[model samples]
Target: MIRTATPADVPVIHTLIRELAAYEKASEEARADEKQLREALFGERPAAFAHLAVDDESGEPVGFALWFLNFSTWRGVHGIYLEDLYVRPEARGGGHGRALLTELARICVERGYERLEWSVLNWNRPAIGFYESLGARPQDEWTVYRLTDGALAALGSGR
Candidate 1:
């Protein structure tokens, strides 16, 4: 059962986010707070959106897909840039990941999005292969850039 997430979904979503970080061996990056999530998702103007996957019979959350809208200058269309996608280890290979991806893609198409994009850590070969199996190709000519901490400081240096 895939459905748009609401304020009530935050606690488990937060836990899932942490689980994903830990799976990637990036637990240090999990800094989300409940108050922030609530305001962001249900505020007067939302900053992001999320979808949750739950067990149809048990009613327990199994996974999530969080994303934000992005504008593609070249395509002259909006794109959906997925921020996170995760399914519990016990649930992997059982079709939850594919179901979530499929639903996200369907919603993207329904919204007339020009692209659906995301990235996986280079060391995660299984995920990479899974994405390739789904027919997604790497943007070889383009390199991902981020402006964090020192990088942001350097940008301010005007060098």
Candidate 2:
């Protein structure tokens, strides 16, 4: 079962985030604590949204999808930008990941959004294959770039 995340699920979400970080071989980058996550997800004005995929038998959250809305100037509609989608290793192959993605797609269709999009690591063959199987074609013409940490701060300083 998939449901929208509530404040009570912050800890589980945080733990799952760490687990996903470890799986991606970037454990050190998973720095946000539950408090930060709670504020981000359930704050007075939320910056993002999350959904949880729960185990049918145990009724425990096994996976999650974190996303936020993005406005496309060309489409003139808000689309969901999925930031992360993960399922515990032990809980994978049970359709939890697909369920989470399906829920996101459903939200887009119901709201008349033009797209539901996410990025996958180029080296992750399994994930690439899975996305391809779902008819998610890669936007090879565009390159993703970001300035974070010092570069971000420096640029924002208007120097």
Candidate 3:
């Protein structure tokens, strides 16, 4: 079952973040603490929303998809930017990933979103293929850039 997540699911979400980090070879950078997640996700004015996939018989969570709304100047409408989508190793190839994406598409359609977008590492062929199979073409013409803690500090604190 895939449904909207609640505060009670924070711990499981936290664990999944770590697992995804490990899988992506960025475990060292996955430093989000439980308190930070709870506050950012469930406190006054939630910063984001998540949907979880649970096992049918045991009712245990198997995966999740987290997303937030973003406005596109080109499209002139709000869209859903998927931040994360993960399914447990033991649950992979069982269609959980596809199921999660389908649910998100439903929400996007129902909400009249202009587009849905996300990125996958070039070397992660499995994920790349999975997304492509869903008719997502790589925007190779465009590039992705990042700003880190050092960059943020330098930008804010001019000495």
Candidate 4:
């Protein structure tokens, strides 16, 4: 079963995030603070939303998807940008991942969103194949960029 996540699920969400990092070979980089996660998800103005996928029989959370809305100026529509999607290692191959993605697509369709998109590490061949099987194509022409910590602070300092 897939359902929207509530603030009470922050701890589980954080744990799943760490699990995802470990799967991606970046366990040390997984440093999401639980309090911050709760605040971000349930604040006065939420920055993102999350969905949880649970085992129907056990009622245990098997996976989660965190996403936010992004505007596509060219398309003149808002799209869902999935920030993170992770299924527990033990729970993989159980259709949980696909179910989460299908729910996201349903959300997009119901809301009239232009698209549902997310990024995957190039080295993750299994993930790549899974996404491809779902008819998701990579945007090869586009490149993602980011500025954080010092660089971001420097830019805000006005040179």
Each model's TM-score?
0.92, 0.97, 0.96, 0.96
Best by TM-score: 2
In model 4, how large is the Cα lDDT of residue 39? 81
| Candidate 4 per-residue lDDT over residues 1-159, each given as its tens digit | 999999889999999999898888999877779988988899988999999999989998999999999999989999999999999988899999999999999999999898999999999999899999999999999999999789999999986
Poorly placed runs, candidate 4 (over 4 Å): none
Q: What local distance difference test score does each model get?
A: 0.88, 0.94, 0.90, 0.93
lDDT by residue (125-155, candidate 2, tens digit) is 9889988988999999999999988999999
Using lDDT, give the best candidate's number.
Answer: 2
Q: Show the lowest summed lDDT stretch of 10 residues, model 2.
A: 121-130
Report the lDDT tens digits of candidate 3 across residue range 53-128: 9888889999999888899998899988889999999999988899999998998899899788888888899999
lDDT of 1 by residue, 4-51 (tens): 898899998889999999999989978878888877777888888889
TM-score of 1: 0.92
Looking at model 1, report the run of 10 residues with the lowest lDDT sum: 33-42
Error of 4 at 122 (Å): 0.5
- The C-alpha RMSD of each candidate to the native structure, in angstroms, is 1.7, 0.9, 1.0, 1.0
lDDT of 4 at 55: 92
